[model samples]
Structures are given as structure tokens and as C-alpha cells.
Target: MSDIFNQVDNSIYSNAMTFLRVPLVMDPIAAEADIAVLGLPFDIATSGRSGARMGPTAIRQASINLAWEGKHFPWKFNLLKKSKVIDAGDLVYSTGDAAEFTQKVEKAATQLLASGKTLVSLGGDHFVTLPLLRAHHQKFGEMALIHFDAHTDTYDNGSAYDHGTMFYHAPNEGLIDPQKSVQIGIRTVFNEANHGFNVIDAPQANDMSVEQISTLIKEKVQGMPVYVTFDIDCLDPAFAPGTGTPVCGGLSTDKILKILRTLTDINIVGMDVVEVAPAYDNSEITALAAATIALELMHLWTVQNKQV
Candidate 1:
């Protein structure tokens, strides 16, 4: 058989693969033998730029270049030695069908969740989060969300699904309890009609220190399960220029990284890094940033899973 696992850095602990790492795994069951990964490349309906469909590919390619650190964290957990992470590949979908794609995501994610395997999700856009949350809610009811973005993604336009209207549909479906959730690093403009979906606004976020923000989340999200959905637009366009939407005067990259690293004890069941549009990117910096955050998510999984 082919090599089961390979090391990105020889000195780092080895992270295993089941058999082979394909480009994108269309079928979650057939493609995912052990650990599964699925991509949701659905960015056609974005209100901002129209190229976030390339997010999954760009993230995968950038990940290939990252050197895995041997030590999981300073705490001495070794994820590379213990965890068996596989590349299940991206999900398959037809062009120009949002509802169909949502159903497809729900079916595939349900299987993956039932199998008791961790799925590392790469996004097509922010809208994908709603369907993923729907699938997970069916498995683990009423999960808390830790959303990081420039906009509070809770808007129900009384229409179909799209990037801007995802969070609004979540509570209506009973998937998310806005009161139990916390939104960080948000900065943008919105209308008065989009209210009632509880979220910590960015104007308030901007005034507080990072420590204060982290402390607030710790207090608010205490004793509940959380899913982290990071939209690349949460960071300033100067820091991440390659997203479907680029909001100005947002969180800096280093500041966001510090925040993720500080939440050492939050129970992050699953995470998704989204809205990375490569078509607008010149240096490919945004993809690399998203991939790095994915690594941080892996670290969070290792740290939290071991504690359990």
C-alpha cells in the first residue's frame, strides 16, 4: 500500500493519512475512509466579489507549503503523533443551484457526523455555514456559535439562501441560539431592519482590548459547546485582501491570531475558515492566512479533545 502518513517537517511529529490525498473528495463516505474533509465551493451568489469559489483550492495548495510544528502547543500535547487527519477532499455540486447544494451539504455532513469522525471544512463562502450548522444541529442540538466576521451574518430577507442572509436563517431553523453565541472582530455598516439576532457589535468590539474581548467571550460562552466560523473579511483589507468581501478598518491578522491562541479552553467542536477569494489576491497571502488559521483550529481540537 501507499505510505499511510507523511511529515511536513521531519523534526515534527508525524501526521498520518489513510491511503492517498486526492485533490477534492466529492463523496464524504466514498472519499473519506478514515478522517474526512469536504469543500463547499459555493460563492456565485456573493453580494461582494464573485471569486470565493476558488477558496478551497487556494487553501489546500497553501497548506501543502506549511511546515507542521512538532509540538502541538507549549502544553506538551502531540497532535501529529496522536491524531489521524485525512484529506477527504471537497464536496461535489452542480453549478447555479443554491438550494440543491444546501441539501447536498446536509446529507453529506450528516453521514460524516454520524460516523464519529472529525470533518475539517473548507468554505466556498459564508453562506455554507448555515447548512453545515443545520447538519450539526440535527446531530448535536442547539450548538453555540463563536462567529468572527466584519458583519453579523444574521439576516432573513424572506428569500433563498445567500452569503449575507445565512445567520438570519439559523435561529429560525433552531440551529443557533443568538443569546448563547458571541461575535468578535466585526466592523461594517448595516440597515436598521436587520436586528433581533443577538450579536456583539464591532463598534463595541473596536473599543475593547483583546483581553477584555476574550474575557467577555469566556463569561458569555461558559459551559456551552461552540463552533468557530471565521470569515476572512473580519480582518482589514490591508491584512487580507483576497476575500469575497473586503471590509475596511477591521481586525489585524496578528490580533486575530492572538485571540485564537488565547482561547485555550473553549470547547471548539468544529470550525470553518471562509470567504477567501483568490481571484482578487495578487500575492496569495490570504490563502496562506486561512490555512494558518486552519492549523490553529487543529491545535484547538487537539488541546480540547485530549482534555476530554
Candidate 2:
């Protein structure tokens, strides 16, 4: 999506609203983008802090720092140059009903995917991934999930709408194949039942090198369509404190980004950076972190689907 996700030459402090000020579109197909960005601004499913509903705006504002820059550092390619990216704006849905909200998100996602554009979501909370999975499943057909978070979010948790239970429900609904998936950066507790996905708990991730973590992720998701979900709380509170459920002893910022950079070879279907609650953040740290993660995701997408 050349010039799609990015706006032309606005100062970082300028009034850019869309994620990186990319042209806002109501219809992705008309834009003919290679990739599209959408905001899932519903946090009704959170079991913790409530303000993730504001995540989309906050992350977009922070992304201004990256928007005006011609190219991202360390990476040898220009994302805007290689791909057409557009901000399709946020999903429009009634805020009153959980079922309706989920349906709207999925419907919006389905429409975007039908355009044959890959999606990168700015989430309202981790629960947003549930509907996202539903949408991607229809296109890619049961992807391998690469989840990064402080909690497994796979708990039964009684209700079908809770953020913690989406993973539990996803595998059952045929959206993802648990055996081919892997969950990383988890520090919270959950039953070790043959949940099918391999676990790289927080301690394990912290102790492991980037090579080890990436190797394990690649091995687990080998030759499969992959969907990556990064919950901002995967970083310690020191790195990302403005999240719904922050956990200590998490991976550092450098550690996670490094791991992501080495993952361009994976067949990624869809991705999101969820659970960033800017209200709890100091000095915009969490939002900026989320923004950077989003950019890195674009890099990953561009490399995988390199355009002429």
C-alpha cells in the first residue's frame, strides 16, 4: 500500500489522527491497498483496567514520530515504499451490546480481508483478538497463533465474552490450530492441560536469547499460516505500564522487538498490538511502545509480501 498507511510529510507534532496519518478510508477495496490498518476500539470485554477503549487514538498520536521519517532504522527497507497501507478508520459499532460489538468487529474485519489486504489492528483490549481470529480464519483457514502477553488469556472464565477466554474459545471454534501455535511472555497462571500450544513462560523468555525464542517460535509454527498477537503487557510495567493487566518480570522492549525483526520469514496472516491503556502510562511510554510495535509489524508484512 504505497503511501497508504502513511501521510505525506507531516511534522511529528502536527495534527495527524489516523495511524501514522495514513489516508483514512471507509472502504479498503477501493483503496486497493496491500495492507490496511483498523482500530478495534471496544474494551467491554476487559477483566481489568477499562481504558483500553482509548488505545487506538493514543497509539496513533504516538505514531506521529514514525510517520514523517522516510525510513525505519536498522531495517534496510522503506515500508511505505514497498507496500500500500491505509487506515480504514475505526470499526463503527454500538457501544451497548457485547455481542453486537464482536459482530461488528468481525464484520468489518471480514470486509477488509475480502479486499485481499492484510490487516494490522490497533486494539481496544486483548479480547479484540477473538473476532479478529474469526475474520482471519475465514481467509487463511486455521492459522498458527503466536501470542505474546502477560497472561495466557485462555482461561474458561465462565463467560464467552471475557478477554481471558478468547484463546480457549478460538481453538474450539476452528479459528486456529492449537498444536501449531505458541504462546510467549506469559507470567500468569493457567491450567497446563494439553491446551495444544507450546508455552514460553516469562521466566523462560527472559532467560532465552533472541535466537532461542525465535527458533522455538519458528519450530512451533513451521510451514503454517501464522497470526501474531502482541499484548503490550508482554513488556514489564517499566516498559509498558499503561496496559490493562501489567505483570512484572516480563520481556524488555529490546528483547521483544529483536525477536519480531527475525520473524519476517513466517507466513503471517494477521497481527495486532493490544491492551495498551494510555491513562496509566507516564510520558507516553506505553503508547509509543505500542506504536513502534505496530510499525515493526508493518515491516514484517512488507518483507513477507515485498512489492516491486
Top-scoring candidate (lDDT): 2
lDDT of 2 by residue, 147-231 (tens): 9998888888547688899899999999988889999999988888766779999999999999999999999899999999999
lDDT value, residue 199 of candidate 1:
55
Off by over 4 Å in 1: 1-35, 72-78, 191-200, 203-207
Q: Write the per-residue lDDT of candidate 1 for residues 1-308, one digit (tens) a residue.
A: 44555423332223212111233344556543434556778886588788888898887766654545455344365555555566666677888888789998888888887877666688888988888888888777887788889988665563576688877888788887777788876666555464554455666666777898888887777777777899988877887899877878787777777778778788776678899999887677888788778777777776667542
lDDT of 2 at 135: 92
Query: Poorest 10 consecutive residues of model 2 by lDDT?
Result: 1-10
lDDT of 1: 0.73
Q: Rate the local accuracy (lDDT) of all candidates.
A: 0.73, 0.89
Kindly report which residue pairs in candidate 1 clash with one another.
25-89, 25-90, 39-90, 154-168, 155-168
For each candidate, what TM-score against the reference?
A: 0.85, 0.95
Error in Å for residue 178 of model 2 = 1.4
lDDT of 1 at 294: 77
